[model samples]
Target chain A: MSVSVSANEVADAPQEARERTILGLTADAWLRILMPLAIGVIALGGWEWAVRANGVPSYILPGPIEVGQTLVRDWHTLSISLWITLQITFAALFVAALLGLALAVLFAQSRVIELSLFPYAVILQVTPVVAIAPLIIIWVDDIRIALLICAWIVAFFPILSNTTLGLNSADHNLQDLFRLYRASRWQVLMRLRLPTAMPYFLGGLRISGGLALIGAIVAEFVAGTGGRASGLAYRILESGYNLQIPRMFAALVLISLTGIAIFLAMTLVSHLALRHWHESAMKERR
Target chain B: MLAGVKAGPPVVTLDGVVKRYANGTLAVQGVDMAIGQGDFVSLLGPSGCGKSTVLRMVAGLIAPTAGRIGMAAGGEATGDVGFVFQEPTLMPWSNTLKNVMLPLRLAGMNRGEAADRAAAALAEVGLKGFEKAYPRALSGGMKMRVSIARALVTKPRLLLMDEPFAALDEITRHRLNNDLLTLWQAERFTAIFVTHSVFESVYLSRRIVVMAARPGRVVEDIEVNAAYPRGEVFRTSAEYAAHCREVSDALHRAMGE
Candidate 1:
């Protein structure tokens, strides 16, 4: 048994010493970036090759090159649409964050408010944004405000629930310590509950960041197709009607990129905020 | 003279302190005890004895369901009463200095003065170089030291500790026990410590109140005549052993026959 243990240790020694890296990136980080890149390249290459080999019509199936060329050709129009979509997404996210955080704090402070209002939050979350968009677009005079409201509705609840959970999660012993110090209600809320809720609120913000984009795109589809200033969703619909399939693909690419940008931005914000104290952001020690 | 026989004026007095939870569970019944000025007393009992309940009541963390507690009027002027919980309840988000500064800040002291006193308190607990270190960076013993530093920062007249060193290893526990005794000697605050360890109770307390569970109340009060400034030598000596045995006997009796 001792001989086998020694042999096992010898086998593990080299494994421990081997510091895996790819072009100065740690192996884990390299794999995370490269794996998705490889998949995207392979998928796009296959689609381009298959369309060329099959002699598919440009209107039916545009090659990746055609899509790339169309994206460059319609840069000015698509860029404007991209900017509009991004503004609505971010504005809605900002409003959701403020409203959700304020409501969560209120709920945390009073059980009566939480009980009365929490069910409505759940109700709002369960109802689909797609179903509510047409009515919202028709009722509101300003199209942008109507779109903002729809996006805010979809992005609001996660922040509320997660912040509430985090607020309630302060250690019981620490709460007693606060009481022992005779900390005023405001002091406890500002110093303790707010800090405790920070990581949870950031987590919810990341989720809401993506959802806000989706809600914006979906709302724009309803509003723009109903006759309004075009965001990327409307650009795609217009391209489809004109049989500019490559431009539609370019518009879709821009929308996907916008979603990715929002996600990355939120992630960077979370990392910056939590790196000093939270376990989630801390670097692991060997 | 016996240790508690020469007790000073009562710093804390509990008269028939009964604690009944809203769930209809009686935690402790008729707990009548008085802590004199500058006393080191231990509420020694097994788990579920409600010794913690009594300490919490004294700290004003909770109210007694059926009785009154009186404190010396001048005790409040010393500072806020300190409470060190079983776990090292230092705020994870704050550094050692900030954690210790919490009480003084709550009392509305300016940041500069509070920082000076907090740093001094941390130094008193042998955490001189660790003022900027967070609780997560410290060991269990060091974390408990930070907790102690925070408790004593207010220059409290009374300190209530609930098994503060019970989670530490034997070596750390003994070192902390010695350190605590030293601090108590220097500061001379009235302290009520709750612990289940018989050896710990004997080693630390001037008067050990052995308690029974199930509507907890004091079963026996044993005074340790062992001299002040107890160390490792005293821990192994005949006098300490004798005191330990007597306390152990009281504890066993407190538990059952």
Candidate 2:
């Protein structure tokens, strides 16, 4: 009887183990998603309760519900501002990527150019965009161009430095192999150096994406332009001046969401490009 | 002591070849070697013996400081040579097919022909279905196979390998060694292999050039009289053992010198 029982248990063991693994995987995945959501809900609930219990005025401390309601109510005006902010951010990011890549390639090709110019790039990065925006606006005479310059300066350095490092980091042996093949200078740059620099470029791009948004917002705050072309930062400022704290909170949420969206998009692009080869994007295998 | 098994006209000839680095180190000195066409030769030595330096000089990667190194076909500047480094040295961003295709592509061969030649080379290295796989997805042995495919894709006149299998495990190394010999026989390319392994040198080369360090120079040369298609039978046979013992003793004496 004991033998029969043990045999039956053995017969059932694989099926039981397989089912448990399937169940465990889903459970782990769900926990990963739901845990953060639960914390957010609890924190919002606590915030709402505190506001109500303390009887804080809407202009002073709008509750989460009021902010959401104001987000919906002020969607028309707020969205236009959001769009304007996005335009500046993306434009700056695009220009930064183009110029940064070109400059990196140039720097990789010549040590003299890099040694002469890299310090200026560093100086531009170190100087606060806020401190320079006023002078740029005054000198440029166009608020948009001035804002772009500010954002570009803020977003350019990482891509330049990262890509330069990556280009220089090609395997010494592989370089020798290329030399053995009598590869041309252009071929070496395109086939070896550029591909080697891709992961580092993408990493810098992710960081630059967030900085671009921050730059645009800060530039708008400094510009203080108060028209239809105003950005989310200006809306926040306007709402603050008008004591519309809920609307101000709504605009702040939009900016944060935009920043999050840009980061996620960059991360997705990096994953798609590098998933096959790069360690950073590859999935862990058992 | 330079007894080489002549196969044909000399493919590469090194006469009093010397290499002194910028930091005042004499890496190789007064090395004279004449590798016959289609011959398999191993530069066998201990570490710091500048075996790699000799190989690099042959490949024209670094110039000899004091002597003449000649290629029969002017192979150095014309991309008529292939080299395998100690590492697999594959571009991680590229797949096996692309990596193997690099030399042909760099030579301005059109895409389709390069692809076909690369695929054939990959098949020759026993990596037929792994063409689409990246280097990261490959095992160390497989990566080395891909590296060999890349080196041979150009169908160069001379193939130079510097300790290419030293990083692999003994089993993989033995397997690759056998595969390499087969490739060399089939391709009929003059091969110059650099290694510190006496057993490996005996197993792979028709001739072994033993070298010593501290102003590195050749100390002894031994000819292996074994026949072609050397395998496990040859590896365990008394003749192979004797050749290995002879090479090992030569290496020991070279080290002492």
* TM-score per candidate, chains pooled: 0.93, 0.94
Q: Interface RMSD of every candidate?
A: 13.7, 16.3
For residue A113, model 1's alpha carbon misses the true position, in angstroms, by 1.9
Q: Where does candidate 2 chain B have its weakest 10-residue lDDT segment?
A: B1-10
Model 2 chain A poorest ten-residue lDDT run: A1-10
Q: Model 2: number of clashes?
A: 0
For each candidate in the order shown, give its overall lDDT on alpha carbons. 0.86, 0.88
Q: Report the C-alpha lDDT of model 1 over A51-71, residue by residue, as the tens digit.
A: 999999999989999999999
Which residue pairs of candidate 1 clash? none
Candidate 2 lDDT, tens digit per residue, B208-229? 9999999899998888988887
Q: Candidate 2 lDDT, tens digit per residue, A5-41?
A: 1122123222212223345575566788789999999
Question: What is the C-alpha local distance difference test score of candidate 2?
Answer: 0.88
Best by TM-score: 2
Q: Which candidate gets the maximum lDDT versus the true structure?
A: 2
Cα RMSD over interface residues, candidate 2: 16.3
Worst 10 residues of 1 chain A by lDDT: A1-10
